[model samples]
Target: MTTSPTTTTLDAVLAGLMRRYSERVPDVQKVLDVMLDAGVIQSPDEIENDHIAFRTMGVPNLGLGSFEKIFLHLGYERRDEYNFVEKKLSAYWYSPPRPDLPRIFASELRVNELSADAQRIIHRYTDTVTSDPVDSLDLDDANAVDQFLHQPLWKTPTLADYQTLLNESEYAAWVIYNRYYLNHFTISVHNLKPGYNTIDEFVAFLQARGLRLNSAGGIIKVSPDGDLRQASTVAQMIDAEFADGAIFRIAGSYVEFAERRVLSPFQDLPADQITRQHRREGFETSNADKIFESTFTTQTGK
Candidate 1:
């Protein structure tokens, strides 16, 4: 089948993101391989990405404001905002101009909310990357987006600083280490075949294949209305070297699976009609809050 122009452009963008994501988190490639080999997904194109998420530090000229410019230039419009006070995170979801493209979910840590000591430690590194790195790129260029996703904006942290941040917030430690790397890419399980249609079934499939999951909110976080269900693999740990020449295993990126239900208005309609209707879109604060735990040391066993 001849691919549409939009599909062609989206394919290039997704490929670029995946290439950078897989470089640091090799498990992502492994997971995709397993799904394909198991016949869970006929091909890479068959597995639709519901969205791609990024975690950033909420400092001057950083975080969502800076990170989002690239996507905005690519035709994404910002949507709802969510606050996770406990996690010290504020996130927003961006809708793609085209329905076939995946949504964008970017979250930033509210650094000011951290203790004075933690904030100082974070600033020591973030201050090094003075300007918004994304500003230097031409968002209209696909290669620019690809390079921006993988570029390290800040210098590496020392073991002391890393431990300090980890003691207060794992999220901060993660950002300091993996600067601007794609945090996670979610697979839209709703698009999969019958046996793997639901989050439960898909989770079971992965479990059976020996992949560990983040059980923060019972492995599957569902919205109060039961329309959105989500789960994620516990982040895999990899050796990370600190400035002091000591290597420690730290939490890396993970993969997520999402299944969104049709809206209540279309729930009672015929299957075909429901499929044609607009499905419930956007992120759930509570569900996403738990999904963020996928990178915690407790969940990842780092």
Candidate 2:
């Protein structure tokens, strides 16, 4: 099959995100290493990436409106919207142009819904972005898009501002410091070899390997219908430099594992005949709510 220009560009953009994400989040390589040692896969590429996520601050000329444009231009279709009321977050999942590509789960903080002082702390940094940065990008240029995704959208935030936001919304503090960096890339566990193919088995493998699992709701988050099961590693901490070069160790990024069980109608199909379409689709709000805390001090402080 011939890959279109849009798909090629999308490939490069995803590659850039994963490369840097793996470098910053040690758990990425750690997970891959354990999988390799356990014969779960022959190489890292053999793993199916279910999806990748990004965090953003909801403010003028930014947030989902601006961020979604990049992927939408690459042929990704916007799926469902999810609201995290308590966290003051709104997110949407985007289906990939090709099944081989990972889906996108992007969320933005509801800056306006935050406390007056918290909003002030966020706007102080985000206000610098007077225009939607994506509007300036030539989406066809893979290199430019890759660079834009990694470049700073605003000035480096001060430790004080970050701390204040953290007290209000950890999501806000994350966006202020992390910007558009990939929050996480999930591994599709359903397709793995037998013993490692289910979320329970996979979580057990990871726990045995000494990897810390996020226990916000439980080590494994199951949807109400029980078709989608998910789990994540507690976000690894990074020594981050704040404005004026004050260094502090804070939550970075984490790896997630998902198992999309075959829908009831497709349960009788032969294993080999089952594809992504035969399984449960989309994300669960309740499962995602706790998954968001993978980076919170509540989890990272553990």
Candidate 3:
């Protein structure tokens, strides 16, 4: 817990992950180091133990899958998603044992956005509902929340209970955060809603303006609300011209699925900021992008 800057390889390794000097990265990296010392073999185990999958020693808010991708970069290949199912979720390995299973910052963030559909449902029906309690609703992503709210999600709570949960619970935090996530469309404003007209108009807007859909990889709806929101999957981005999350004016324009505000692969440190390398460093996979690509290549059945 007390990692002194002097005489600590763990500290040096962690410093590399936090090269950008991110506060979130350090706390999460610290968590990962503890887990490593405790003999956590796979990233998911670390997540199960402490509700985090840090790319570095101290950051927990980044996606667990991102760190897994880092493992692939090192060639510490594990079973596929099917293996996760086949082994009851125990198959895992790491590549380049130094950085082990962590990173200093977040990843490319276009695909991971909150869906408008989720916002429409959770916020729209928050009041006047008695059976499904808003607090009990799964609120990590808009799509999942949408799915959960479709039926009597909360065993029939009273309106008061719904309000209480909405006021003081993780569900509320999720919805409020999603509202923030959905607001980040730096592109042209074609529509403010997700209806037939809005979706169509937005699609036209992206095309007419010649805007690209972040990376080729589109979307992954964590909730039912995300059923409509999509971009390209990592593989789709690599192999196909269009993606599952979007029809490119074919089916529909991409909508947010993963939370957007998080850091992503498409982004990089700003131009003017000096890295000011730490006296020490966090051992990381220099070729993380290559590893990222491999995960998609191997998984897409290509």
Candidate 4:
């Protein structure tokens, strides 16, 4: 199967877009203003209720369950969340691999000034260019077992290492359960209370306490149109049984289950065959509920 084209060429193009758009679209501060105008999400609600967090998948190192804990803390029922890195990100939300979860977990983003055309570009790129599995473990419940094996976290990352990953792996994660877009990076605004207009408001709130968040430094990207933005981060493949940093990138929490490290192969699959394999392996495309429910037993709660 085809490995992801070197991350440099693809990621560089996306990074340039991030820098250009950050200026056009407001950051956290501007997001607050827009939220007030649209009557969508509110300031207090963002901090207290709709608190959000995220993660990203690095190629070959599919960190699928990366942000399940974060989403759980926000009161998204753990059982309701899901992940996928096997197909297109949009496809997962549009048609989930798992049929159990509700759309409420799908954070409907409001691309404020984001042109419809720009949005299409973003989606099309991922659909056509990024729709392939880097590698996966061929074991039962592959994603689940791998997540347990590698608990990745470079928490004490030196500034040098932090900036390094940004250039190569622009990773992000979503909790949607659609097989087509499992482990895709999603920004679900629905987690917040109504009345907030834009997503920036919440972004600002997240930046307040100085928590480790997606930023311009590394593993993040902005779109070319100066309207939409995307960020990526790596999942530390940690396991007491495994060596420190013996990690592989993940798609959401799904680890590519294999006896050893390898890239996911579902990428080179024929379009029709991909679907057939999905069905043959009883490939679950959605798991929105399980992720949401994982939050309850998490330590992120106040």
Candidate 5:
């Protein structure tokens, strides 16, 4: 089968994301190493990426409105929308053009709903973006998009501003510094060999290997229908530099493990005959809510 230009570009874009994300999040390698050592997989390429997530600040010329365009232009179709009332967040999951590509979960903080002080601090940085930075990019040029994704959209935030945001919304503090950096890339456990193929089993493996697991609502977050279950590592702490040259340890990215069970209707189908569509799809708001805290101090501070 011939690969379309769009598919090729999407491959490069996803590859670039995973590359930098792995470097930033040590848990990614920690998980892979344990899996390899246990003979769960011989190579990293064998693991199926369920999806990757991004966090943004909902402000003019940025946030989901601006960030989603990169993947949308690459052929991703926007799916369901989720609202996190308590956290003041709105999100949408996009289905990839090709089944081989991991789905995208992009979320943004409802800046307007935040406290006045938090909004002022967020706008101070985001307001500099007079227009959507993504609008200026040639989405077809994989390299350009890769660089844009990693580039800073606003000025370096001061420690004072970061702390203010952190006190109000950890998510805001994260995006202010991380920008478009991939939040977490999920490993699909259902496809792995037995004993390491379920969220429970996979999470156990992670725990036994001495990797920290986010215990927000629970170690495993399951959907209402009990088909989509997920777990993630607490965000890694990195020594971040502030605008005034102040250094502080802040949360970075992490890795997530997911198990999308085969839908009831397709459970009887032969294992070899099953495909992506046969499994439960999309994300669950409840599960994602707790997953979001994977970066919160509640989880990281533990």
Candidate 6:
């Protein structure tokens, strides 16, 4: 199919996201290459991304508000809110202007909910971002969006501070080291061919190919309605250098697969009545809560 101008722009934006992410997590590129080699996808265009997620520290002049402006300018609208009290996170998903574009899942670490020491450590770096970085970007420009995705909003932290944040909240540590990084990109399993149309089947495919799956909350987390099934690969660890000049292996980004069921009204209806009704929209908090562990040391390992 010929790509539209809008689609072309969106592809460029997504490509930029992948480029920034792949630089830190080479496993993502490997996964995409393997998918192509195995004939799972004819090309990158055939792989429909269900959504892309980002992690940020919860603080003034930062967090979702600052990060979302770029997408918002591109006509994406906020759709749902999710709170993970246990993880001290507050997230929201954004719907794209067009159906062809992927959804956005951005989460922020609730800094105030952490210990004083941890909060201090987090602030030490976030404070360096004197102003909202997104404000300085030309949101309407695709190239600007790409630059903003890779722009570091804060100074690098010392190994000690990173360890302190890690001890308290792994999410905080991840943001501290990997600022504005794409946390994960989810594949719309239903869009794939029959052999890989379900989360269970896709998870098996990844495992058979030697990709480690996050076993927390099981390999697949299902929604209460059983309509949404999700799973993610345990993040790949990579060497990271701290401000103090020390290098350590840290958890990086991962790939996620999702299979959404049809809506109840469309399930028993005739084919005519069910036109455009096969996919379940929005996200599940329980499923996302576990998916967030993709970048944690416990899930990714040392």
Compare candidates 4 and 5 on TM-score and give the better one.
5
Question: Per-residue lDDT tens digits of candidate 1, residues 43-122?
Answer: 88787789889999999989899988877876789999999999999999998877767898999999999999999998
Clashes of 4: 75
Per-residue alpha-carbon lDDT of model 5 for 117-173, expressed as tens digits? 888888988888998888889999999999998999899999999999999899899
Q: How many backbone collisions does model 6 have?
A: 0
List model 6 lDDT by residue over 169-241, tens digit each.
8889989998888888888887787798888888888888988888778899999988889998899888899
Candidate 6 Cα misplacement greater than 4 A, ranges = 1-11, 268-277
lDDT of each: 0.85, 0.93, 0.26, 0.28, 0.93, 0.84
Report the Cα RMSD per candidate.
Answer: 2.5, 0.7, 21.6, 20.6, 0.7, 2.6
TM-score of each candidate?
0.92, 0.99, 0.18, 0.24, 0.99, 0.92
Sorted by lDDT (best first), the order is 2, 5, 1, 6, 4, 3
Tell me how many clashing residue pairs each candidate has.
0, 0, 42, 75, 0, 0
Tens-digit lDDT string for candidate 2 (42-148) = 99989999999999888999999999999999999999999999998999999998888899999988888989998887788888888888998999999999999
Task: State model 3's lDDT.
Answer: 0.26
Cα shift from native, residue 230, model 6 (Å): 0.6
Candidate 4's residue-wise lDDT over 102-167, tens digit each?
Answer: 111232222222345433432432333232232232222324323432332322222233223322
Model 4 misplacement above 4 A:
1-185, 217-222, 231-240, 243-302
Q: What is the lDDT of candidate 2?
A: 0.93
lDDT of 4 at 83: 41
